[model samples]
Target: MQTTLMIYDGTAPADSGVPRTGGVPLAPAGFTWPICGSSCGGPLQFFAHLPVEDGVLSVFVCQNDPGACESWDATSGANRVYLFPREELQPVEAPATGVTLLPATSAIRTHVVTLDPAEDDDHDELAPDAYDLARSGWKREPEERFGKQREVLGSLGGSPSYLEDDRLPACPACTDTMEFAAHLEEGISAQSAMNLGGRLGYVFVCRACREGAFLTD
Candidate 1:
């Protein structure tokens, strides 16, 4: 099994304002901060700014109280995600009011890892995010076993992990079910993980409404 490999030195960089995944969040000329509808009633915290096909996927979540807030409740208004056309976008300044940007931005590089069935017949049985399984397999193999680690599950273009299929969210605009967009996890390396405070963030969007949502668990 060949999987996407990410280089994790734990130093992901962002643009001047937003924490970098692919740079700044692109919005129209008169863009304003996304209001958090959660009990926090503040600006949703900026989570990621990923580049999509000809557009940018901007993500944010509520940070009123990491201990008591429902950052994962879809209707709690704790999170927001948006995909804007690149041509119609511009860099955004971090809001002065809401959740503050993380201090360290861990950078990530995506590559690939090739798995050889010959290495271990049981290698085929490992789950996608099976870190323990992969580590065990490596311990049994000779030196220089698998290519780079498949890396943790949450990075650009990868499916969200730790989520139930039935939990797919609905788009607030069209009232139609939204599509699973991406997952944002701790940054590149364990040392510089995006400082998500151990919570995994998920991004969803409705192209028809040009709106998106984010949640954490």
Candidate 2:
């Protein structure tokens, strides 16, 4: 299987239209900052600005009180994902009183990775997850294993890594199962990493409905 890995590409302009994490989101006019409805009742923190094939995926998660809010559940309202059109998108004005943005804006560059089938072994009964296999083999230098893993921002257009079938989200507009869109990692450093409770983040979308969902695992 092939997966497009999102590699960390250093700091970027906060409002640039590029695949990136931790930046002010670009949205259509009249779009207001999404507030965390599940808990904390404050604005959700902007997580990423991903430019996908058909549109941009703007993600937000509750940071005001991470543990207090159910950000890991797709329907919990503590997190949000917007599928906005590519044209006429402008930077949103963040709310002044809540955790609405990240400390830094980190750019991302795509690297297409192809994974070969796992060798026949006792564990071959179950098919290997492509994303997991690709991620594990990302580091080229054995000595820089852990350090190189940190450069992986996430991946695009691949199956969710280790996500359970039951956790897949349904489209709010049509109630249909959504397609997996991307996997997001915390980040390269503690100072800018998204506080995901040491978990991986997932994004899903329903193309026909032009809707999206967010969750963590």
Candidate 3:
């Protein structure tokens, strides 16, 4: 797991002034800014710093994995970067003026893999944000479906990992608790090693009542 910081200038907004042609003023060394996700070969570079509504300028790290370690350093990082003028960053539709552009919604897609015990403790903390993004999708730039990570679930017969969408037996409609769905005789993904954390079992809502929780092996 890698961490990136979002730095926005607190100063006031102004018209397109002189282009600040240089690297960002600050960021952690070796942080990889994401232009897109690993699956899409993203976590791309920032063309340049962007100015926001209140004359605020902002910078952020790319969360994509393939471009994880890439940076804007003169020596180590790539030279070509992306920069969007304030006017260009404005809203396409009316009543939504003065909003900064983010990575395209499609570009923000990620797989927030939940972990079971003895897998990777370091990743558990990172699960929520990643999972939220994977399930609901992003709201900012490049409008598109963030989409579900249903593809990540795969099948239970071969792999040992389980996806929250598949394991958390909730009523698809109201999300009420469901009954026990089933336990796989074999592993699902690498994460099926533990019975806790919604792995090892399948839960479902009452066909009528529709309420459920996970039952692990």
**Highest TM-score model number:** 2
lDDT of 1 by residue, 116-164 (tens): 5454655466544432233234323366555343244354444555577
Give candidate 2's whole-model lDDT: 0.89
Which candidate do you rate higher for TM-score, 1 or 2?
Answer: 2
TM-score of every candidate? 0.71, 0.94, 0.18
> How large is the C-alpha RMSD of every model relative to the true structure?
4.6, 2.1, 21.4
lDDT per residue, candidate 3, 87-187, as tens digits? 43431211122112222110011222332333433346654433223223312234543433222221111121244434444454566645432222111
Ranking by lDDT: 2, 1, 3
**lDDT per prediction?**
0.59, 0.89, 0.27
**lDDT of candidate model 3 versus the reference:** 0.27
Best by lDDT: 2
- Give the CA lDDT, 0 to 100, for residue 109 in model 3: 14
The reply for model 1, stretches above 4 Å from the true place, is 1-24, 114-153, 188-197
Q: After superposition, how far is residue 44 of candidate 2 from its true place, in Å?
A: 0.4
Q: In order, how many clashes per candidate?
A: 8, 0, 36
